[model samples]
Target: MTWNSKLRCFFLLWVLNSNIILASLESEVSAQSDVKDHGEHDNEDYSLERAGSFDQIFKIQQTYLTVQVDQLNSTNTPRAKDEKRRLLKELSRAHGKWGDQHPRKKLLDALFSYSRYFERNIPDVNRWRQLYNHVSSKHKRLLDRTVSYTKKFDRAESLLRQNHFLCEDVVNEALSYYEIGREELRKHIADAEKAGIVADKMSVSQSLKHIGRDWTDDGVSERDGAFPCILDSIQSLFPNRQSSRYKVLLPGSGLGRLGYDVAALGGFEVTNNEVSAYMNIMYRFIETQSKKDAFQVYPFVDGWSHHVTQDDMFYQLSFPSMTMNNSNVILVEGDFTTVFKDSKDKFDVVITHFFIDTARNLMSYFETISSLLAPGGYWINFGPLLYGTGPWVQLALDEILTVTEDMGFQFVDGPESCGSLTFPDKKVRNKEAAYGYSPRALTKNAYHAQSWIARR
Candidate 1:
């Protein structure tokens, strides 16, 4: 409110305006100079856009739309933003400029389908897609082949870049397409009123395998290699086939298939535990289904890399190859370290299948595992050292055993040769094994995960 302060403020604004004016004049002079200095070709018409030929314009349009749709995928989180919606709307209103061969419409449709299904959620979309995969071999091939031709249209980097959307305006258009899948996912959740699925809840990059790799017949091969160990341990401890004699706990039981198989084989009270809501929803969904191998999964729809053909991405797998109605298998849902932490001297056998490395603190897991087992209980583990997220203490095989021994447990049996992951001085004659993988996939993840059977 003082004269001096008002004068100073006016002076600053005047100086700023003066500088902007100067910059504008300088830019104008530079443009004029460049035009004057051009060679003799400058005498001819130099209008850039107007001078282009029909073919040039066509190419421009193709590239522009391609880049526009490509840019629409700059993010993968959500579609509530105004700019993203505007861009998609602008493209949609373009009046079908591209010819029949052009991929504008196809790309647009694909993106739309992705948006609607995305509302249902990624795991839901894939689970819904299982319907397409399970219909028949002939139809499955068609869905597989279609991806080969449509891969380049436009997609984000996740899930093979399958889902991206521009606006909520058009999201409803594809609802009918997505609703069938929505209902399927809902029904799956509705089917199983109780029970849960195992999940680490990592990003899609890590969790995608839960649905894609955990249930397939190929995935079963990994479990098949580990199952015998549990059976052998059980038989060694209690030779009789009593219904409730021995108590076995399986943590990180994705899809509950491993536990299902163990319980199906009979003789022990088996408990399967998991933490992922997505997996839990699907598992419960499978619980109510009647047909064996009726559920299908096309998990690689977005996993375009390390695949030879589109069909490779369409690698369909029918799940629960043989569903057993086992009443003895118990579904316990919660984190492994906390759910049964208060209990002591309970479990007869604790099984870990590709699960031990999921711990952040190896000592805590050992402590928990040790606390749960009876004095003569067996702690059987088979998995690679693929440690989960951080603040984790990663120990070598020797270091892990040392820690296990420190937890008031005695080491027994061999780190023994089984899968390709076991690295003993002498080569073992076991078959090459993978946790979860498609054998024909270009990138091979086959490894001999080390195996061990310890006694408490």
Candidate 2:
């Protein structure tokens, strides 16, 4: 009787425990499903979409590089062999010293061709490990397609694999910046994970190509075409010039050159706001430099095309040709609209250099600028309307001026040429501004950037 009763009680206990475990498992799965659902349904997906989009963004980057390397290394087809011969011929012409016998030719082959510069100790590229483990099946297509249709770049071949080194420069710095950003982005992802919600991804991917030359003295001509005009307008339009330094907002201040220039020139408190993590870390990198010409930049190492000479093709220049660190300059990192949305009338002047085109909706940017500037504050813009990527409304110059005026601004007469090259369309004074321009390069991507002085 005792054995039968004890066996029945043990069976009852075991059955109850199994049911409890089943219920717990069901609850956990249901909770995960609910979180997944929220990510899909909510505007801000706190799910796989948001969390995994930027996860291993470097995978695409590296894959693209690998694709490029493969292209340069490929000599299978007739076209490839012809291309190789052509490149060797070009190299032969480049340096009477460019031949195989030259010391630098051998050195460059070791430095770029065979070196693990893009991998190994590089912190930015290496940091992808954290994000690499999270790319869900959904976003795998992005990684797959980045280099799928990518063809050999229509560039001159480099016998020593020197053509794409410009990409290497920017990628290293960009990935380094990505490392800094990755840490911050992980924080947001973790918070969302704890809350079981999808978080918004970090900053949009911005081209970091300019980062290579942003801090260099080679960029001085580009700056002269814009920065001096920005300062002149600020000094002329701003009141109480001698009394106190006026707050000037410089959005898209890459590597802090324009902002530092204004601060160094005196009479202005410069706020350098940048969105690219690449630029921010690079700026911080420059800020830490104790001496001038601390770094070297090869702006044209990638420009195998559009070059008349080997010197132009393989020019070497020092970064920060001069480091003008001023305490008056403060950098704010984030989107222009989001960072200063609430700060109405906070700036005495707003200067945009090659920045207006950065907006998809120029009206939104104008509104933000209007709100940020106090009454009688001036907005001096110097940049061509080269609307790039995304859904940018490519408005004609006349339309832009009209819309800008409609956005509650009065164009004040200024200099005939803001800096260099003038465009005569509207009565308002405007001019062309060049960015990343080097006269040394046979081909230049100079822009007739419209310049204007508008009062809010």
Candidate 3:
């Protein structure tokens, strides 16, 4: 009786344990399935289109606000005053249009008006004092009331706007005005701090001169010697006799050495376009200095041509001011990317030295150069493409070449020339080694850079 009873009891216990384990496994699988389903549902609920649309609107608004604020904070000369008024009018109109549609619109409109008023009138001590007194008199109550009202409107608008996801496009447009208001507020603070502080004109002029000459070897002799080499390379590509009265554009003309040299060549009319206002001022200063030094040093330099006559000298401080010069130098101050915005196949030669690598938008520079070049016109670009900045230099080259060819320019000369020029940093024996160089360098970091002559 004892053996048979013990076997039956053990079998029953084992069967019960198996049933319990199966139940637990089924429960775990069901829980996991529920979790997966919940995650999928959550993902579907958070629509990417909705979030992306909102973000786009937000950014547009931010930019608009910034521009409006900047305009308000700008110097209020007659032109600036007119611009401010126009901007304020536009802001008011936008506010009026949106205020009726959205609750936050009124608050946003008030903020815009306040910004304009502050920017336009705060410069007057009397006006500012009056404003301060008014604000101080009703400080606690008015501040609380304004804050509470704005919050309420903001919440209401947010709730209403969320339901009308289709109106994301409209909301995006309103976002621009909101951004303008915000940016103006920021500029108002900055302009307020800068008020009454006049910049030193002489110091600014000197700083400009230094910046113009910064990239070159600082010694007067070195810069003077370099001019002949630069002109030789320039003349070799486009011979002086055949070059005619070619319209030459030299951008970043720090102190106008290259432009002055080209002009002095007699055949080519060089226009110097310098971005820095200080550089332009310094360029004029140098012209005066050149006159003073002309008798003493002009005859010694063999290549120094007198073709850059006083009558032939022309300069543009900024891009827009650059006059179309067929036989004279045109100095233009502008972002090279937008240089040819209105150019009508006018230029015959576009030359830049040590300008390409320094550009932030390398492709834009090449692209602009290609666009500015007339048919059969020469594009001379000489610069260090790859320096200490590793992959970025390579990427810039790729972008420049890609844009150059895309804009219908053909590379006509070698970008592979290897030569040793004196390093700007004279302290460094191995220039490449000084800038964290490895043995397996992708491009040469030698003192002398490669030159490319392209034709469009």
lDDT values, one for every candidate: 0.49, 0.52, 0.40
For model 3, residues 1-456, the per-residue Cα lDDT tens digits are 110101111111123422311121111111111121222222222222223222222211110111121112212245334433543453454444553333233333322222232122213433333454555546746755765422432333232222222112222223332233334433433443356522233333243224223222222333432344456656776675554666788766665656755765667766666654344433332332111111101110111123233111111011111111122344454455654475564567887766666566565666677677777887776555553453233354445556667778776542222123333322111112111111122332234444456778
How far off is model 2, as Cα RMSD?
Answer: 25.4
Enumerate clash totals for all models, in the order shown. Answer: 7, 5, 16
Over 4 Å off in model 1, which ranges?
Answer: 1-212, 342-345, 414-432
Query: How much does candidate 1 score in TM-score?
Result: 0.54
Number of the candidate with higher lDDT, 2 or 3: 2
> RMSD in angstroms, all models?
25.8, 25.4, 32.0
Judged by lDDT, which candidate is best? 2
What TM-score do all the candidates reach, one by one?
0.54, 0.55, 0.40
Clash pairs, candidate 2, are 46-197, 46-198, 47-198, 95-98, 384-449
Give the distance in Å from residue 368's predicted Cα in candidate 1 to where it truly belongs: 0.6
lDDT of 2 by residue, 158-241 (tens): 211221232233323332322223333344335445766421111101222354446665666776777777777666775465
Model 3 ranges off by over 4 Å:
1-221, 224-226, 240-243, 288-290, 294-327, 386-403, 414-446
Which residues of candidate 2, in runs, are more than 4 Å off? 1-213, 342-345, 419-427
Roughly what TM-score does model 2 have, to 2 decimal places? Answer: 0.55
RMSD of 3: 32.0
